[model samples]
Target: MCVSCAWGKPAKPHPLEFCENGAKATSWEVTNRRADRAFFAAHTLTELETWPDHDLEEQGRLTHPMRWDAETDKYVPVNWQDAFEEIGRELRAMPPEKVDFYTSGRASLETAYMYQLFARIFGSNHLPDSSNMCHESTSVALPESIGASIGTAILSDFQNCDCIFYLAQNVGTSSPRMLHDLQDAVSRGVKIVTFNPLHEPGLQHFVNPQMPGQMLTGKDTPISSEYYQVKNGGDIAALFGVCKALIEADDALKASGTSKVAGTDAIPDDPSDAGTVAFAAAMAAADKKHVLDHDFIRQHTAGFEEFAAAARKYDWAELERVSGLTRAQMQQAASTYANSNAVLMVYGMGLTQHVMGVQNVHMVVNLALLRGNIGKPGANICAVRGHSNVQGQRTVGITEKPGLVPLDKLATLYQFQPPEWIGHTTVETCKAILQGEARAFVSLGGNFLRAIPETVAMENAWRNLRLTVQIATKLNRSHVIHGEIAYVLPCLGRIEIDEQATGPQAVSVESSVAHFHGSRGRAKPASPELLSEPAIIAGMARATLTKGVVPWDRWVDDYSTIRDAIEQTYPETFKDFNKRMFHPGGIPRPLPARERKWVTRNGKANFITPDRLFPEFSLGAQSDDVLHLATLRSNDQFNTTIYGFSDRYRGVEGTRRVVFVNTADIARLGFSNGEAVDLVTAIDPETERRVSGFTIMAYDLPEGCCCAYYPEANPLFPLDHHDTKAKTPSYKLLPVRLVRSGVAPAH
Candidate 1:
């Protein structure tokens, strides 16, 4: 495994252990072009729909199992047992709740527990993945705050956290080995902060090519000791202005008192009451024990007096007019988080692609539960998990909105019949194939109609389905946007070499801090006609599961027989799962809020509140010619894999269409330095949604916000918007307007 930078592991191994987009994601999976079957018999679904998704994934890898012949509209080749017997005869002719499935955090946790155990034994708990498009609001707001949606610090608690925060994340173009753990948490003095409305440069200043006097003085280091910008759905009004300035500095250091005093027989409260005796002698010479941990919020949390009466119902001039940030930058970020005793925070997908992303993760867990900051040493909250095994494919049961995987202990350890309703997400599988009630989609690796959000109404509700498939290894553009029968297949990539038939196996992933381990594969395969995402989900669960209690051909030939049925179905989080994944730096699973133990439903640690602390969706309420937008992701791309059209850390270069905005909102929206444009959205007087040329560019954002890039603005989003309790897809805000339309390039 070359890159496990999804939090902690390299205690020692370093021979270019990965980064620079993990060596451009392993040189875009050992590239040397392949697509074969005569490159889909000389490309044609109207010339691979005019290419460009990095030229149809650099026209490489795919190799076989094709299908979509729709009167030879093209994707020819077929085999792999007649594409799993015509996707199991068009998914047993519909109604496994009409087939949805769709994973892709680049598979392999034994192929996402054998693709959610062949979509709940070929029945259907729709099982969506890519964590329902980025941490489904920290998996439904950190299990109602601190119970567990992962991340209670641990990467050696960002090296003793003294204060971190970095909200609405960017970590220098999404996880550049978390800038060597923010350069050892800012060389041990910590403090960071950030917030984000743009101005990102790896949260400003990094360099560290593993230091060596910063490559002989190229210097760098800094990383955000404060930033702020905010405002694109202003993270629950900049985290309720740092929890109303840390509850007004813990009620002004408990109403002013001791100025000097050794055995204080009083006398301090009156130098003519000098500003409440210099705010209680600067909170008694800072010995008030760093403001508020109050014995970890009186022994492991709960709704502190209704989240401190909704944090004294927000004031500081409506938290500086909805977090544009002022009141002395939220009192110097509440005096660097009440003089830090350990903070952490961290966020991303700009606090989960908003519509009040689970009330901006319940106001970032009501300012880390007002100082208890979840569990012990170096406080918590992390979130920054973008893609790499996307939280290990929702820790092995993939999911489609259910609560922490139990399914009656996976139907009594994989016997079957579980599906008790709740499924289809990824915008309810495009509103169940545009309300014709879904019709077979499958996926097992992503690009779900180009990382979702309206992309032409999810490719016209997946072209009114009736079977899609994908399984993927390269060729994207959702394999030439098909349906009414499509296929694709391919597979084996985590650096190739798979083999099967019970011998050289390996697989098992987990990482982004739930740990687990083992990944194995050492190059070679790009094609030996692919196959090995758990043997194409055990050859489509032994040809559409007759459910012979899952041996799926001896767990795709020895993946430790699928880690012994994932320790008999998540036995208290994979206990002894193949001998704790051969130890040496592996087994983390347990969590119980990292041992404070609130596993939710009111066991403890909650404080959620926020029905509205501010930012109840605001882009021009109806239309000041809209704007908001957001979208982003481009340091030469990763999700939706573009790899290069240059972002070169936001100075951009060459191009990826453009936008960025706010040099006084481009001189009050008239626009100039590089114009062109278009965008749109509308959704009324007979619908809209545009997206033309783009350009714009100004910079250093945050004025009714802007930005672009996604699956190129995922077609101005509207697929029934999103986030009513984390259904996700608000794709970082999106309202739109733009217009102009021509003239920019040149010099």
Candidate 2:
């Protein structure tokens, strides 16, 4: 069972706790493996470096502190004191800004807070983190539209919504727990509409492995009521098309004298509507049953007029061509959503990991605002995060670019002058390293080398660094890509308990829905030699900083003191952090939107509109014989960490070198199923930007779109190609030409 599943409740056991995906996560974490000094001794650094990612991880878990010996190019065992002292000396010598503190979602909140505090105390704001790569776009865009950066809806809202609009995300494979919610919603007659390029099986049918009957019979549970395979990067066009259809539908209703606009409440406190007649008058502006949240639009937001004008100016026909969805499908989704009492819209990396990722998020927010779906139960926007504690990491200050509140509060709480300037984000950090501006890199968790785009370049940058420290659970690619002085410190995994000078420590985590909960580990420590993240950080801070520079030892010995410090900093949110976290389910932070209290400067929810319908990046000229490849994971994969190679739903066998291309595209390109081909990306003409020797497989995907596994094809992605506003790599839109290995051009 997953850690959050059946283990949480005693009486009412969750039926989907033991799903195949959860089993994979658990097995991978609690594997019977140990990669100690002996294992490292057996294999030379060069030999280990030559091994594939899976083979190295499968070798075993690390059991001792290891330091890279540059002479031998191997990791030699060292005492914890020597490793910490060496790292401390490096940090003490360099300017704080020269060193970047990076963290992964797997790190504990205590560790994350301490890491940020230590960096600030040491006089650097360089805290490039994993979030910058994935959901930084969401964090950047959502705050502008809504008062908060997080999703407006909670998980419980799923049970109350009448209709659910799911876009771009494959919930079954990415988050198996989400399927249970979808199935529950379907059973309650919640009309589910899915927009994706391929028909995901989880959106079709999901059989709970925990359900004895379903598991034995192999019967599947239904998920979506209707599914539409929109073209890649076509979400914006589809949204505009649906909104246009909605406008048309409203006009038709008005002509028939059956419009609901007549009875709805007034557009609260809209001065633009001042001296204007009624709610019907404002409704008449759009000729729709619901207009945008006028009060929310006017005060707390900007660019309403521009957004409304763009919505009014968009043409259905143009949207249809761009989206590749029929006018009927667009009309159906719009009408279904408009008529439903409460509708919830959900999106994931599919929409966010684009060059126009922020704009894409704004469009989704625009759709929700038009129907007044936000700030109400069962009707809001949901951004499904990839990492387990990603939301919590952001909450606890694992950020390179800190917000005004976080920086200001941190300065006051820690008694240090925090840097006013925005630090380097993930993309910026990579650029800094390449430019020789950043010298050292410290990662709390996550394989930075494998996770980031432009793999070869990032590795080269890592090699140039002065020192690289990785506090990890097991060996990954990042460990082998050593700097001049590299240290690999094994830390306790999420499933393992952290025992310190005080007692068992508890860490807090914020879920996707903005609910904060306590995550206490029950499993034993992987090894006695391993140190908790907090202790490791505390030791480093003590070694680097002079005495009384900060209270590092006090917080490290007792983690509750850290929570108390967090409470002091964010009193409103975490008034009684320690006491409240003691509750079975930690308290939900106060979101102004939850109570319809907008915290914007205008103190109202605002409608923000962009001058353009979609960003320029989304609109591109179609290249002949070139397919836009979107890299994705199979049911067996999790981010960059692959559990196995078998994708059961795709019906693929033991290999990741398979490409999912449409049959028509295959015919047009003159490629057959299982034909070996080179998918050359249209990125860097000088360099060979192609993933060679991939078996072409025909799948039920849309035309002008193809699919392949990531990190493998990540080489094809250019380093500079990213979202202009958010800097998230456009993994979804890689224009490339496919060719047979030895065959000449058809021309």
Candidate of highest TM-score: 2
Candidate 1 — which pairs collide? Answer: 172-202
Q: What overall lDDT goes with each candidate model?
A: 0.74, 0.75
Alpha-carbon TM-score of each model against the true structure: 0.37, 0.91
lDDT of residue 714 for candidate 2: 85
How do the residues 1-747 of candidate 1 rate in per-residue lDDT, one tens digit apiece? Answer: 643235556555445545787788788878898878887877677678777788888877888888878776888887898889778877877778888888877676777877886787777888877677777878778887776876766677788788888887776677788788777888888989888888788888888776579888898888888898977876776677667555545544554432221211222222343333343345558776335565566677777656665665666577666667876786677677877877888787777877778778777877887777767777877777766677877877788755567777777776777677788778887887778788888887778778887787667677778788888888888879888888888888877778788667787676676777777788888777788878887887777777637777887778887887777777778887887675766777788887678888768787777777444433434565566888888877777888779887777787788888888877776678688887776443245677888788888877877889888888888866777777788888776778765432111
Q: Top model by lDDT, which number? A: 2
Candidate 2 lDDT tens digits, 1-747: 133221121123374355666677777877778988778777777778788887878766678999988777788899998888999999999988888888877666667778888887777778888778777888888877777777777776888899999998888788777787888888898999899999889889888766779989998878888888988888888887776555444434444354544322222222232222232344455455443344444434455555555655666677777687887788777767766767898998888888778888888887777667787889888888877677777777767665644777776666677776678888888888888889899888888888787777778788899999999878889999888899999887767888877988888767677766676778877788988888889888888875334677788778899888888777887878888775643577788776766666666555555445444422225557767788888887777777778888888889998889999999997778889997776545555566788999999988989999877888778777778888988888777778887544332
Model 2 collision count: 6
Scanning candidate 2 in windows of ten residues, the lowest lDDT window is: 1-10
Model 1 TM-score, all chains together = 0.37
List pairs with backbone clashes in candidate 2: 35-60, 35-61, 296-605, 296-606, 297-606, 297-607
Query: What RMSD does each model have against the real structure?
Result: 21.6, 5.1
- Give the Cα error of residue 61 in candidate 2, in Å: 1.5
Question: How well does candidate 2 score on lDDT at residue 436?
Answer: 87
